[model samples]
Target: MKQYSFNFSFEVLEEFKKLLPVNRSKKILKKYLLNEYVLSESLNDLQEIISETVIQPYWMTEAEIIKLDRLIKQAKTKGYSINRSAIMRDVMNNLVDRYRNKPIQKSKQHRQTFKVPKGIKERLSLLIEDGELTYELSSFIMDGYVPSNDFPSMRNKDQEDLNFKTDIEVFDKMDEISSEYGFKKGGRAKIFRDALNQFEAWLESDPPKKAALKQELKYILTEYKNVENISIIKEEINKYLKE
Candidate 1:
């Protein structure tokens, strides 16, 4: 986090040589000037190198070297040790080998395909039943809309005079109720289609949504059965009246 500035010279190099091994002194000195490590001793070494060396160095100027020294000191205080070039080379090679051996991830662009489940089939069947139930409820309401000759007691009277407005209202209310139940078209047809698509994905990937889709299927089936029973009862009544 701390910034630094410095001037490089032979006197700085002498100071750096005191702390670094003789074999590594020049290499470490070059790295120090490169801002590889910020050490107090390295800064002193830079001063020594700059003062003793008569020929001007071309890699970095005195001002740049001074900046490098400050950075080295800051990095040292933060407990960061500089890695030697040889060490970095080995580490990079190991990383490359590990990456080469690891498995590649599948592309999201690939098309996903899966088989339909039996539960989804059952859901489709339930959707059909629900559709029939909605139609039956609609018929009940429609019957109230017009008078029927089957009602022998009221045969001579106008069916409209029977005042079945409440029956019509009840049928309209049923539609509102079904709409709130997440049934598009007053039935589970849309839900069935969606669940089938999700189920197919679950079969392919066995993702977490699979359990949720299964639970949803159970709910739809139960609701469908209830509506289907009501529809059947209504059908029976309508049939008897026709006979």
Candidate 2:
């Protein structure tokens, strides 16, 4: 974070009044001038002392202000560099963090879905027959892809099926299934590849059934883990759709 210095004066006060209506302007101006009073000291040390005592006290009073002025004069006898605005802002930020209790909001998690377009599906089916598409690619496709109006439906299905699962779960399940079957490459990649192969076979047998099966696989994968593989799958799906 960077620190910023602002110079506020009577001219600035006039400019501020332009932003307010006639009735509200006077009240605002009065408050602004009163706040500005702490900034009137010439020496840095005096300014700092006045700011810490008067401005940083949470509630300003006449007796406090007088005491702050005395402290400011005392500090001037010594030597220190202090800016009124800096101290005031520091205190204000602290007060806000303590009393205001603002909390940062995190982004909501969403489930994965599938939506195959008529054109993309046709192209994919052609690729499958031609043998240009692999089980890996098909797996990626089954995971999720773009350039289809059916994506919303696929996503909804995925959510309903694998709502609470995280990415690690998917990875673990893939490993477990592959190991049980004595898969040569029993890793996340291989499990995903296996899943894709099964999905593509379903797609080839019944084009109409591909969508439903894809949604099922997506739900299954989600149960295993919240993998970001969907991004890669989506990219491939887009590339295929573009072709």
Candidate 3:
């Protein structure tokens, strides 16, 4: 989606479920927008759009701001370019995966030490990817360990390496993310790019400017194809989002 210079604000909330409930429906008229985005119509219109869309406390701390500032400068010296919001997007994704998958303890009784062969995390990741136990990463390890006899069955399954292109299933959730951020228009690349570029708006015409965006868009579509790529790109872009 093409961005504008318009600005707006919202009283945000936390948790994805509250902001975007499963059975929610948008009551705004599609025709209220020029490109059909009620947001692009006016600042007030944009505010109203978000009033129904966003419900999260969203802000940056001074430490986060400083960290990103340094990252952007470092990346420039190394001949790279990215923006802060992209960096935050990546950080959020990593936090999600890292906390969601890594074994953790709510209390002492929750700690279940498991002795298993390598690639166990990879194996249990299936259950998480399949949405069997998103809230139970520790259970995955516990179950595999408590039933020592089941370890063989879990590991011996004739399963291929999780295909980053398809097996790493975060891309399917991109739509939910895009819609929440109000980039519900345009192709996948546009949605991703616009969300990352949410903080900036500069009118760029002429072939050179167009060419640069085209190149960036191409790189985004091809390079960020999977969860692994997303992780890698986030690391690189963290440096760019700083300043």
Top candidate (TM-score)? 3
Compared with the true structure, what per-residue lDDT tens digits does model 2 show for residues 39-140? 334454334322111110122334434544454455556664444344333333333343334322222322333223234435455534333233224223
Poorly placed runs, candidate 1 (over 4 Å): 1-32, 41-53, 61-69, 72-243
Scored against the true structure, residue 207 in model 1 reaches a CA lDDT of: 27
**Local accuracy of candidate 1 as per-residue lDDT tens digits, 9-120:** 3343333323333223233344544444324343332223111221111223355456544554565566644322222222223333433445233212212122322354
Evaluation by TM-score, superior candidate among 2 and 3:
3
lDDT of 1 at 230: 61
Give the higher-lDDT candidate: 1 or 3: 1
| TM accuracy, model 2 | 0.20
TM-score, each model?
0.14, 0.20, 0.22
TM-score of 3: 0.22
lDDT scores in order:
0.34, 0.37, 0.31
Deviating ranges (above 4 Å) for candidate 2? 1-167, 182-186, 209-243
Residue 218 of model 3 has an lDDT of 60
Give lDDT: candidate 3, residue 74: 60
lDDT of 2 at 42: 47
